[model samples]
Target: MAAIAALSQNERTLRYVIDLPISSTEYNIWKPLFKLFLSVKDDESTICGRILQSLTRRESDNSQISSYWSSMLENGLLSTLIQIFSLSKNDDALTSAFLIFLNLLNEVPQIKNDLDTIKNCFSSMLKHTRSTNNQILTLLGRVLSCLSTDKLLIDSMVEQGLIETLMILIDKQRSSQIIYPYFDCLANVIGKSYEYQRKFIYSKNFLLLIVRSYLQDYDLNLSLSVIRFIRQLVKNNEELQNILAHYGVCEHLLGALSASSKELQQVSIEAIQALSHKNQKVQQILLREHALEQLLNLLERTNMSTLQVAIVCTLWTLCENNPLQKRDVATKIGVRKLISFYTIKSDEHLLVVTDAINELAKCAASINMNIQEEINHAQGIPYLIRLLKSDNEMLVLSVLKNLQLITCAPGFIANRKNQEIIVKNDGIKLLVALMMHAKCDIIQVESAQSLACIALSNNQCSTLIESTLDFSYSHLVDLMHSNDVNVQLKASNALATFVYNNSRVQLFLKNHYQFSFDYFQKFLQNNNESIRCITAFQVVVFCGLINEQKQSVNTAVGCGILMDILRTSQIDDAKSAAAECVARLAHMKSGVPQAIIAVNVIDYLCNLFSSSNDTTIGNASVALGFLSHIPEGRRKLLNRSQTSSIRYFKVLSNNIERSRAAPLSDYEKEQSSTNIMNFYLPNIRQKV
Candidate 1:
């Protein structure tokens, strides 16, 4: 301690303390000793002239000295040093205080709670921001950067017209390089106040000041820092959406996209991307200016992880809103070239690849169509198929969804051999794997939908039914029991289509898929209305579409289930679906009409006459009209108890008798009698 204090007094031995361990308590004892060595604090020696000699000693030793200085900054000593720091007039002493302060603030909990005290001290420092020594201003800038997030300190700085002062220091050609720290602090403070962007934007001239400073200075770090603030300012302020319409900031930022510093180029790219959000005019300008080419050039040269992330994000934005731009860009830089970048081994790069692929997949469906010929020439399917097995679940799901979109379009999967290639390459296996094992229900549902689409292709349709009917039927039943409503809805829809297209599928349903009907009924009881509606609708579709030729007996039971749906809950739509399903089944040769009449179809149809929804009433009326086509249904309608207060039947009979028609189409006569039956019938609430 004595040795460093003596050196500080002479300016010769001070260099030695730079090598001493600053983190150790023993070495930190010298911090108190500096109070006596700082004679220049009272003298008029050129601040830099007095400080340069000692700074030289520590120039190559910032780490060791920073550590030792930080160890001395616990609690009481920090306050005493702040007091001494306030009294120093020499720029050298001010610069040294900040250097030591930076180290002290780096200790998290120490300054976290002391922000108020620190802000008060900083207020005193800014009073001399115009100190003739540029070094002092620069040191103060560094101190401000460390404390920029502190609200009180920022307000204090803002009160002093510090923005103009920092703008002066940002002029690197004439300003000292030390001013970069000040620029950093200024940028960070601006970034924190996004919610107040309007207040800040309208109240201050920060944009003009930064743009002018950037034009003159052109420092990569400073320009990048300012660009980040611009990003934040625009992000939190919707009013700034039209910035490019007025200010030339967009042009300067585009120019910066070509900067030599990869970091600066990325910041510029990110700023441009942020500006382009929902601003088609800004995107058009960038596109017209060929800014994308500039970004791509940077992507090709830089392999830095952050740069790649920014580049991917930029490309993703351009691609999502404007597919023509992506297709055009893909024409110049082949899709494979862009996708192959993900093959880079770094985990960071892989994370970026995952994000990029997810974004790209949103546009992938569009791209696959526009570039199908070109992709076929390049064999793009193989690349897409490879991503299906990627360890990343999200990436796999995204790729699967895009591939499905490609296959879903008309005539895209026409070739039987090309369709088989997916199965042969285990693509179907992967879809099945996702259906069974993927952790996310959304992914599983998407995969299941994709499989159904693939099975729809004429080339693969019948064969897919024959080979996988048993397992797929069972799987669909199990997925119907899934807690995920989307999964159950999709799985049920797929199963309906399967049973409709293949009569043989009905045997499996009878033998192996019986559990599905019970679960389907449970789904109808789900609290989510969409789930209940769709589940009931799907069960109706399956029963209505079933093939009586292959499994007549089970089809009879399916018909009874449809009738039970109506009787259990005359929820207008469920009743309508039940009625529609009955109409379809009655036309079948399976004696489903006998089953329907036995379930009291006449009473169920009359209950729907009071339904307020026109469609529900119309559907129930239409189904009753179909049942009236049968002789036995007419007998059941007239067999009701004479004493029954059938309000609806009375209305129908009066309407029919008033019309004076001895003869009526079975449809009209049945509708008339059902309406009359409804008037005499008491309102009945059926419980599922």
Candidate 2:
């Protein structure tokens, strides 16, 4: 320590001390030497510059430097440095001081504890931000950026007019070196504080000025900084996004997509994504600007996996809920490009790309687009099924979701073809594995839903799913016992759909597992509206599929639970589902219809005929229709008090007949008309 102090007295040998490769054991030597240099008291001393350079060199190890900084802080080094930074007019000294402070604050987060010292230094730092020295301004800007990480320091900096200083520097500064850091400082400081963001945005048209700069500037670094600032500014703030959209920010960002620099394009795409996420107005703005065409063009031309991923994400965000854009993207070969990203081996890339494809497939299925066919034609199924083996739960979930959407297409042929492809590709095995063994509840739920989608309305897929090892009715019953409501809901729904019209599976479940009436009552009585609603639908499917199970289900569930749901459920869908369950029970040959009438469900059914919800009306109509199959139900329908109910039934039947003018075949129309007549006119002559 004494030798180190003596060496600090000679300027020639100080370079050797700075260049010495000190091992970890010798890190203690820096503390006393730092103290000795701080005692020099000369703001312009070369010792200060040499000490700062030595400190910067030792910054490679964060733990060692953090410890060294902690020791130095105990020795009044922060006060001395703030004094040097305030008093020094020497550029090299100021630069060195700023570099050391930046490194210290970045490596040792505990430095934020000394908020008062940093607060005292803000005025000096703001004064230097106006410096003509590019190096001084850049270094000071970075130090300010680091200081912005502390909330209290940011408040103090703003109080000292840091925002005004940064805006001034950004407005007039053209040097990339000077502009980048200032923009970065503003992005960090204001981006973290909502109050500062408001002040910066609403104080003096500062937001407009930044947008103009972003639009007019073409320098790579400056443009990147501006876009990053904008990205952070509007990250989750939709109102600010709309304000930027009013200034045509989306159009300018779309133009950036055509830039030659991949990095610029990537950042620009990210900024656009931030602006357009879930903002339908901004999404429409981007679509009008032909963002779809330009992004697809860039996607085809770019070889960078990251840029491709960004483009795919932006495209999906724009196309979501916008069917025209979804069709346009499909026409522009967007589906093919999205599928091609699966060939990339990087996990991060695969995760993002698969998510995008999943969303795209969802939108396509909603609008009945041929995207499923397109994906299959592009050979995208194998890639998706292959990704089901990924260790990343999110990736596997996304793949399963894509498969679910593909198999659940509205068109029968498309649905069957996709299911066949999945079955042929061993997709069922992978999904069953995830469903049984995945640690994430959400993954298990999604896998179960995907398997259900495959089995929906397809006997082949249903049989295959049932035959898979450990994925039979017993496994689904086990899944229904999980603590997670979502898992239970999905598993129950899967079981319901699995046995829907599949008499063989229904018999298998009946013979294998004891149908728990208490469990079904608990599910129906769950507080969550979705759970109750799905449970009711599950009951409907169960009673409708198997004749032998209806009596037991009716005796156990009773018509009273369905009546309570129909009477008390706030959700229209839940009411409709419960009413449908009542209709299914009324069809049972047992005394279920008599039990339903005992609940005085006749008046409620009559009242539901005037319901505003179409599904409710249809379900109630069907319930009353099935109830009319009995002698007491016919006598109740013919009562003089049920005149309006009878008239409503006649009108609904007429509407059904009018729908025969639709695209239905003669046989379909005849069968549907005959079914409606049988329900309403069972005893019409006796009633009149």
Candidate 3:
């Protein structure tokens, strides 16, 4: 003790004493030694600087300094430092004291980790943020941001009026001096706990006050810090986001987005994105304020992945399900340039870019040609196709949606390049994989519909051959009866394409298929009218082309199902489908006899013939003309004399003759006019 006291008298000796590195030591000696130069009443002017310097020096060494800090904190050394910060007037003294606290809270976390120490520590730091000393306030901001990691200290700091103090600093000060530290303090507190967040959000319009400071045209650094604080505050809190947006604070954020500085632009883009998330009203507000133009401007100026991510994400929020806004963004940032980002960004940013593109595709009716040509020109289809092989369900689902959009666009089919992309990328095989076996029902439904579009675009049946070469016919058939109505419709439509003029496919089904037309006939009665319509369409196509297999269809489809579709369904397409299926079957042996006894399709056809729908009248007339040759069918048709439309069936026969007479031989033409019944009835008589 005598020796240490002798050294403490000299400045150099005292400096050496303060600068000594600490190891695990006796707390009793360390506290008294530290107290000589540390505290509000720090012993010497030079001693406080030396002490902070020693702490700073120790911070640079990647060694354990916590034991030294832990010993001081245990022995009230922290209390002494806080007392010095509370009273010190010298910038050197205050600055050194602030650094000591930052290290203890930030570097030597053992002190902050102790609940009892941090509790008092938080109170002291909150007290210091209100300091008139700018140096103290700045250091306190960083300290609070650090200390806020303790979930336990969250309510303690809020109760100490921390939020109110920070709010007052930013609102009242026009100077940029305390801006970062001021909002940094609030961001720390609000980020720690939801209770604290609500307290700030609901109190004094705390968030709006921070946003107002952002508009002060202060230093770019200060505006960025304020924006960061705003982002941290409302990031996941939908309710608080609503409050800020309601107060028109989101407009200021948009203003910041249009600022000249890139940093402020980046942070503001992030802030707007934070507010726009999951809050539909705020998205509308952002769109109304022309935030999309601001975002495109930023995207053009910046190449940083982080900034690009922010801009892309903001576009995503602004454009989802709102096609007009999507077209607005897509036009400003050309579709070609937008899709060109696919290969440049990392995985995370790529996700944001692709999502923006995906949303834009929703307005395909308006933006189809521009986007389709660019996608084909960019060869982007194969890249999107490969994403379906990913393990991430959301990524794969997003890719499926974009592909679906591309396949169904009107310009997509006419271009042929886009359709070739789907085929060239083996999109059908991937879609079929997701359709039959994906775990999520949504993925299954989307995949099926995508495949159905590809089938519909079969230019010469080449797409069908490419898709169904390794395809599971059984899986496709099974999807026709799936519990999901979308899956059923898509499956039935694909089946129509699969057999359209592809007699090899029909023969293959006949040779290897297990389900009868009965499986298809049952879906005709499904409550969904579209499903019934599509099912009837497939039944007609199948019965029309497979003349050699006509008897099996007649037995499986039967007359009753056809009549039910023709009678019960109000859909014109569905009734037309039933009439066409009935017409196709009328040529087979006993086909008319079955209709007369089982389902009474002739009476339904007669009723169809009297309709105002041109499609219905033509279909009904054709089916009746075929039936008029059969003994029982003619008897049934002759019996329904109640309506003049049915009695005027001969007029329909005259129209069919006139339309077909143009290409017929002279003998056939004369014969067609002689007997309208002879026009269609010969097939029945010849087959019988």
Candidate 4:
């Protein structure tokens, strides 16, 4: 019985080794064929082709064939095969040899060392491409496609004018089988290499050829290949995208969205996305082509998650910074569809979905209040708030940012409702938790920023935030001491916004959490310019919200720190913030004005009146106005040497006149202008 088993195994091995139609698990069965091919002395023997066919089959059978590569190279099998390819006239022999070479290029890492020997065969392949045999042309194109993977071989192919040859063949070849391989080869050669890209672009009518080929093709496979080529060609190349847009490539890509094949539609969508990225001309062209209408239709019809994601991404690129398109998307209920992406629970899908929602929210927040309302009415808020519990930090950050945009865009009056919705959903608790306990500093910082946005000018949200069990003023104060400057800045800003004009919350913090000016001194003197700027602004908010009689808080954030900022800080925003803080302190009238005057801040304040920053100039005028209220500040202002006190007063008075004429409403400007006219000018006139 053992002898019979051995006999059966031997028969199977002979069948596999002799190129019969059989299979075996025996290792290195192709070695016997390699030995037979090597023993053949005649270069014209058909045995070479047979052995090459066996090798190709073995390579396909096992991808882990690199173990035999060293022995094959030692036996000069690759050189011998290339020799047969160059000299053979039989199409079968040529096709077999080309397949083996293609396989070698893919599998053997050591093949790159022998690139010069292989490069000598490109001329022979180019010659055979002119043959009327479709099989020869297809195999030649495949061989070139495989060779195009290496930079050295790509340079060789370009130097030998393979691109020009392939383009010529593409123009002449009417067979889709032949043309598909040529397009594949060209795409491979031009894969992200700037030199090849430039050559393709500069070539006369090359892009036109590609667009025409893609738009006119009937075969789905050929169209897919050409569109993929177009995708690769336009990736990150805005110049090529614009040129192709002029050639009507975008219109054709949009037309492809209606294809029956899902794969063709997917590739076509990807191609359109690559073309329209950051290219406003292409984006406008796509919009005019009814891209939004078709994409929305596809989004509704496609159950394939990847295709849906691609369609959503294409919509995002088209609508980015294009308000006309965004408004159009909103008109079509596109925001509702975008909100639906949150239902997908895969982290990959959620990350993309959250990013799209965030960007759409940002765009809508800037110009369209109705869109923000649309997102809210679509139940976007609860979906976003629920994502806050995700273990993925990036997804949470994206949701937080989207929530912030919805609640705090500058002109978005509907944010009041969004803020209320967030609070209703317990988003405040989740945000506070992230701000206090998230491991990533960026997440912590973004969480704090989102919280600040929620609390901005909304007393209801502020009240809820102040009462959340896990949240406290101490948490914010602790975050302020973080080693990261951004963390410190964001935490300080959140604290300030939490307390801004919310006197109840402010009182609660002071009475329960020991919130004081002492917590801010370190930030006031921080070397980071942004920290100093935001810290000073926080102090401004703190002083403005408190009673004027709280001199200890006013004096604790010393006039000298602000004076030093005005004297030494280079950033105009920081200087403006510092000046504003000084104005807040001086308005207290608890001898802080005299202290500012005593510190000689009057000279710095007067000097800042001529600054380039409008905020700085306005805040400086207000600080001087407050200083002029006190008798001591009045004496110092009227005694300046370089510019007359009356001249400074005239500049202040002119600023007030300009404020009234300016179109935008500035509350600080209105209040300061009123105060200057009502009180400071009378004192200045009496002193003058």
Global lDDT scores for all candidate models: 0.55, 0.68, 0.62, 0.68
Q: In candidate 2, residue 180 scores what lDDT? A: 81
Say which prediction, candidate 3 or candidate 4, comes out ahead on lDDT.
Answer: 4
Residue lDDT tens for model 4, 335-424:
777777767544555765666655455431211133467778889889889889988887887888888778764221226778888888
Ranked by TM-score, the better of candidates 1 and 3 is: 3
Candidate 3, residue 277: lDDT:
81
Candidate 2 lDDT tens digits, 475-528: 677877888767777787777756654566777777766555556667777776
Worst 10 residues of 2 by lDDT: 658-667
**Candidate 3 C-alpha lDDT tens digits along 1-688:** 4125423555446445544664435324455555554444534534645544464456347776644565456667676666665556556666776677777766667665454443354555555555677766677767766766676766776776767766766665556755676666667667777777776655645555655545566677677777778787788888878887887777778777767787777778878878888888888887788777777877898777677767776787777766456656766776666676776645655565666566555432221134555667777788888778887788887887777666544211223556667877677777777877888766776676566555543544244634564556666677767787666766666665555434556677767654455556567667765466456546655664344456546445545566677778777766766665565455433234354434677788777765555446655655565555555666666666433433355545554443333233232234334554444322333243
- Model 2: residues >4 Å from true position, as ranges? 1-79, 89-96, 99-124, 130-135, 146-161, 171-176, 190-196, 345-379, 386-398, 405-426, 433-446, 452-469, 474-493, 510-688
The C-alpha local distance difference test score for the whole of candidate 1 amounts to 0.55
lDDT of 1 by residue, 1-688 (tens): 4444344465445546545556544454444444443454444223323343244234454444333334334524456446545666766556665655554665443464565545456556666665777766666666777777666556666665666566544543245366566756766666656544554456335556556555346766567667776776666354674653356677788788767787777777788778776677777777777778877777777778677767766765655575446645544555555566655544434443444433333221121132333333445556667677777776676666556544432212222433455666667767777766677776766677667656643435546534652335566667767777667777776666455334455555756544335556666667654355445445544663333323444454555556566667746556655654554444333355666677787777667656654334444544554455466775565555243345445433432232222233233343444534322222341110
Candidate 2: what lDDT? Answer: 0.68
Q: Give TM per candidate.
A: 0.58, 0.62, 0.65, 0.59
lDDT, residue 545, candidate 4: 39
